[model samples]
Target chain A: MKRNSRLSLALHTLSHMADDPDRVRTSADIADHAGTNPVVVRRVLGRLREAGLLTSEKGHSGGWKLARKPERITLADVYLALDESLVATANEDSDPVCSVEYALHRRVSGVLREIEQSLVKRLGETTISEIR
Target chain B: MKRNSRLSLALHTLSHMADDPDRVRTSADIADHAGTNPVVVRRVLGRLREAGLLTSEKGHSGGWKLARKPERITLADVYLALDESLVATANEDSDPVCSVEYALHRRVSGVLREIEQSLVKRLGETTISEIR
Candidate 1:
């Protein structure tokens, strides 16, 4: 995602969470550290929770906690959990009327898919616990 | 770039250019085929020209022509020429006051850089000539 920092925020907050995996971090606290607002923190972290990478509670002391072991959570896991792509897929012309455009799209999409898979594989090599 | 289709546009145009490498295509024509405007085609092609991937002429009958052999123009050249990143770098908190934040930035930046470089390398492996 170009210039999008949600991944950065998610990773940074998760790195802190990895240090104390059991500790619950309020969205407000994460927002404070991330230099953002609680709503934004919740939005990003919410995606992680939905992906089963995290769990959140709603009480006043409610916050987010790791749903899995720090070592079990790879950067790829967080990246995938966010369910967004750093490399934008050229899905344009899903059905091109032109042959050249069609071929280019097909070939480029294949290459991009390969790169994406490789990227995920590389990311999977590093767990959140490895960050520290 | 997030959801940016400039790469797809450039590659598609160039792939067409490859078919008749010596033939010049007007910006208006490229735009029409790309389902965009001439200005957009000019802008994207301008970047490719700067990267020595393509060349343009002025006035009537003026248009874009491949500056190099299609084999010499790799997707990496086109991608880098855009000077935009598909993968968002975690350059936030460049000067983090917190150590965890600092380490996360450093480590994440490293991982992203690796992915970017690997992406470029993979892109370089495919030249415009090979696209067809």
Candidate 2:
């Protein structure tokens, strides 16, 4: 599994936006601050916008701004916007004939599901406002 | 971030081993059952052995077996052996000037640590014997 840094980057960007909600920040500005490329910043922020946590404008003076107050944006919202599964099974297609494998998959899947729920619940407990 | 299937694969392999403790399973055999390459199986299982959950013999008729009772092995053991951090920060090294990023990192890090502890605790609650 490859470690994902998008959530970290997004949270960093969002907190910066919350610090000065009245000031519209461009993707370039975010990218520079994040020490990454603008494309990466745009991609992450685009998801946040789609999730309605952010709003973007097209004009020169227009850029990105938070759609809702920082207090309302939870880390769980950011996690969902990133659209990555918290856990994944090794066998994409399991063999039904292998009962041992079947039982193992079922048990691990149950545990992973619980872990994901706990993670998301914890994320929901934290807001961007609180972090910033 | 790419989703990792190593833990799932390791659990599947371990449960299979537990199913028939008397059988010595080779990496090739495990790979065939896992629908993955032998090298991948060796890498994952090697980590398990290093963590004292498995034992391996090198010559002919030599293969892999559980180092401890199935009931003694926990998913947390496998997770720690994998040597991958449960959560990774977007910025490997944070910039001191960016207080917002600093604060976000600290807060998210705290939540992630708690999540990891919860996940490990849940994993410890289930032994390979229970799953098998």
Candidate 3:
């Protein structure tokens, strides 16, 4: 559940960010609150930045801040930004010779794919503003 | 995604079993086919047994077999049986002093819980018989 951990970390970090959307938060500051390493915080922040939900400024008095209003961003935005390795069922074999294995893999994968889409949809129902 | 791996293993294993639902296959046989250890196979089978998906027997000519017909079993049944520590969002703190953390956890947890329910529902749509 490492991926889940990251998702939680990002959500919590963003919740804090949502509290003060305009305030700049250094990786150290975020890490301190989350009790995690600054590097980890930076990585997650970087992902959000790339996704346009956050902005990071470099230099002596620079850090991270929300790029948009909290209400504009959804939990789905944070989750989709991270795109962590999926918890999915796939064919274990290199080339499944057995039709049974192949068919099972195909069917399970399709179900998981659909589930992921619905998950994203459900997550989008809640905005960052609503969470905080 | 180890949980997903186990899910895949159980599904593929069951698909094979569906091919010959009445066949008494030992853990060793399953382990060999899945390229995993017998102990691992036994552990997974044990969970399935508890879920009433499969049955186990002891003695010289004993192993594992489906408790019911493949047509009656669904992918959700296999997924539900394992209950592989959910991939969920949760409150990391013992007592979240920050209202932001508390609200985010409660909100995200609910969203993920709903998503899981949808996932199970989607999985239930496909029976083991349909996969193979």
Per-residue alpha-carbon lDDT of model 3 for A1-132, expressed as tens digits?
Answer: 244777777877877777778889899988777767899989888898899999999999899999999999998898889985354544345466466556656766665666567667777887877762
Q: What local distance difference test score does each model get?
A: 0.79, 0.76, 0.77
Arranged by TM-score with the best first, the candidates are: 1, 2, 3
What are the per-residue Cα lDDT tens digits for candidate 3 across B1-132?
244778767876888898889999999998776667899999988999999999999999999999999999998898899885344654455466477556656765665666667667767887887763
TM-score of 1: 0.88
Considering the two chains of model 3, state its CAPRI-style docking category: acceptable
Poorest 10 consecutive residues by lDDT, candidate 1 chain A: A86-95
Enumerate the candidates' DockQ scores in order: 0.39, 0.37, 0.37
Instruction: List the candidates ranked by lDDT, beginning with the highest.
Output: 1, 3, 2
Q: fnat, candidate 3?
A: 0.30
Residue range A1-132, candidate 1, lDDT tens digits: 226688778887888888899999899888877777899899999999999999998868888999999989998898898876655464564547588666666776666676678777777888888774
Better of 2 and 3 by lDDT: 3
- Off-target runs (Cα >4 Å) in candidate 1 are A93-95, B90-100
TM-score of chain A of 2: 0.88
Clash pairs of candidate 2? A1-B4, A4-B1
Model 2 C-alpha lDDT per residue in residues B20-127, reported as the tens digit of each score: 876889999888877788898898899999889999999999999999888788877887888656554333564544775556567666656665676666667777
- Candidate 1: lDDT over CA atoms? 0.79
Per-prediction fnat? 0.30, 0.32, 0.30
Looking at model 2 chain B, which ten-residue stretch has the lowest summed lDDT? B88-97
Q: How much is the lDDT of residue A69 in candidate 1? A: 95
